[model samples]
Target: MNKHETYAWFRVVFIGTACAWLCWRLFFADATGGADIWDRNRETMSIVSYAFVFAMAVFTRPGKGVVADERDRAISAFAAKSALVALSLVVLVSATIIGTEGHADLLTARSNGWFEHYLFACVMFGWWVESAICVFHHWRDRR
Candidate 1:
C-alpha cells in the first residue's frame, strides 16, 4: 500500500497495542497480595511498546515513486498545530485545577509526582490526537 495508508495502520496498531496492554496489566493480570503489576512494570511495558512501534515504523516502506507534496506538508503542519493547541489547553486546565483544587503553590503542583503523571498522560493523549488527525486527513484526501 501507499505510505499514508501504512502510516495510518501503524498508528492504529500502536494505539491498539497500547490500549490492550493497559487493559491486560490493569484488569487481567493477577493483582493478588496487593501486588501492583502496572506500578512495577510500567517502564518495561512502555519500553516494549515503544520498541515495537519503532520497529514497525522502521520496517515500513513507501510505494515506489511516492513522495510527499504540498498537500501532505500542509496536512502535517495543520495536524502539528492542532496537537500543540490541544496540549496547551490540557496543561492550562491541569495547572488551574491543581492550583485551585489542591490549594497548593504553582511550584508544588509542577513538582508533584501526581502532576507529572497527569502531564505524561496528557502528552500521550496529545500524540494520539496528532496521529488521529493526520490519519483522518490522509483518509479524507484519499476519498
Candidate 2:
C-alpha cells in the first residue's frame, strides 16, 4: 500500500483502539458499584490518549514520494469540509442541549465537565471521519 493508505489505516486503527480502551476504562471498569469512573481516571485517560495521538502524529511522517497532487488535494479539502460540517452539527446539538436544560449551573465548571467530554468526543470523531474519508477516496481513486 502507498504511504497515504498506510497512514490512514494506521490512524483509524490507532484512534479506534484508544477510543475503545478509553470507553472500557471509563464505563466498564467499575460495573459492580465501585468508585465513579469519571471521577477517578478521566483526566489521566484523557491526557494519555491525547499524548499517544500526538506522539503517533509526530512520528508518522509520510514517505518522501507521497506528494499531494490535485486529486489528493481535492480529496483532502472534501474531507475537511465534511468534517467541519459534522463538527458544527455536533456543536449545535450540544449547545441546544445545554441551553434548553433548565439547570442554572450548567455552565459551572463542575456541571460542565460532561459537556467538555462530549465536545472532545465530537472533535475526535470528526478527526476520525476525516481520515476515513481520505482513505476511502484514495482507495476508490486507485480502483
Candidate 3:
C-alpha cells in the first residue's frame, strides 16, 4: 500500500485505541463520570493525533506548489460554511438545554461546577472533530 493508506490505517487504529482507552478511563477509573473523565489521556491522544497529522503532511506533497484546484477550494469553502452553521446550532442547542435544565449558574465556573466543565468538554470535542475533518480534506487535496 501507499504512504497515505498506511497513514490512514494507523490513524484509524490509533483513534480506535484512544476511544477504547477513553471509555476505560472514563467509565472504569472515574465512576463519577464528570470533568475528570477527560483526564490526561484524552489530552495526550489529541496531541498525538495532531502530531501525526503534521508528520503525514511531510510525505504528502511535492515542493510547495498550490495544491488545491479551484474545485477543491470551492468544496472546502462550502464545507467550512456548513461546519460553522453546525457549530452555531450546537451552541444554541446547548444553551437551550442549559436554560431549560436550571439557572445560567450551571454554565458558569464561579457558580455552577462540573456541569460547566462537561458542557465545555462537549464543545471542544465538536470543534476538534470539525477541525480534524477540515485538516484531513486539505491533506488529501495536497496529496
TM-score-better candidate, 1 vs 2:
2
TM-score of 3: 0.47
What's the number of clashes in each of the models? 0, 0, 0
What tens digits encode model 2's per-residue C-alpha lDDT throughout 102-128? 744534433233444545667777777
Give the poorly placed runs of model 2, Cα more than 4 Å off: 20-36, 59-63, 101-112
Flag clash pairs in model 3: none
| TM-score of each candidate structure, all chains considered together | 0.65, 0.69, 0.47
Relative to the true structure, how large is the alpha-carbon lDDT of every model?
0.63, 0.68, 0.53
What global local distance difference test value does model 2 have?
Answer: 0.68
Looking at model 2, residue 82 earns an lDDT score of 90
| Tens-digit lDDT track of model 3 for 9-105 | 5554654455455445433553434444445334665676678668667856755554556755564576567557766787788678767747554
Residue runs of model 3 more than 4 Å from their true location after superposition: 1-36, 52-66, 102-143
* Native-structure RMSD, model 2: 4.2
Clashing pairs in 2: none
